[model samples]
Target: MSDLYLSMGRKEGAAGSLYWAIQFTNTATTACALRGYPGVSALDTSHHQIGPAATHSGSSYGTVTLAPAHSASAIARTTNGPVGGPCLRTGSYLRIYPPGSRSAALVPAPWKTCSGIFQVGPVNVDGTF
Candidate 1:
């Protein structure tokens, strides 16, 4: 449950693909979850949401569900490459959540809650979570 890095926040063009990586340490015993999703936009504060691309942190050229004690993992390169102007280049973030299989009070959202949460990245703007 320590030394973790959930690499996310990659952007692409419309219907395009993206890439990123995730790494960790001292967590081979407990399975930790790294939630990759869009953060509050630096340009548009009123629109904290998904957008121009499709699968924002997904399963197939999208998000990643990292296993605990996994140490490190590098995401594949993206298909969309880059998009918009650098300002609209898109920004992503990562949240570290753990398994909620035996917990309560947590909603257990896939890539949001962090508990019983799943990895999602090479993020997109469509907000698939």
Candidate 2:
């Protein structure tokens, strides 16, 4: 599995958010899922790029399953919120794996993550690895 990070620009005075899209090539024979709905991350500039806002959801998007040998994509749109997690939106982050391959930590914490510095979720977040 792999991770990608994006730094977005808000529409002036609009709350900053995370908008992501994942494109993957099917390498496994079995069906797979591009997981990411309702993802949660607390406010920690040192750890997470996008900080928690008074109104955020778990994940911005998710794809239940993908056909084998087929290429697909998913999008996530994140925002700042109180509790729980982000909700499904146009853009989102996705992590894909073969049937039941999700382990304790499918994806690692982005080593070079973003800082809660800007309004668009985070500014110049580099920890997409």
Candidate 2 accuracy as TM-score: 0.30
* Candidate 2 residue runs with Cα over 4 Å from true position: 1-18, 33-50, 53-64, 78-129
lDDT of 2 by residue, 1-129 (tens): 333221222211125444443334456677656544223232233333333321222223335454666554333343433224433221122222322244312233221112332111111112121
Q: Note the Cα lDDT for every prediction shown.
A: 0.32, 0.32
Per-prediction backbone clash count: 12, 25
What global local distance difference test value does model 1 have? 0.32
Error of 2 at 60 (Å): 12
| RMSD vs true structure, all candidates | 11.1, 11.1
Model 2, C-alpha of 99: deviation from truth (Å)? 11
Give per-model TM-scores: 0.28, 0.30
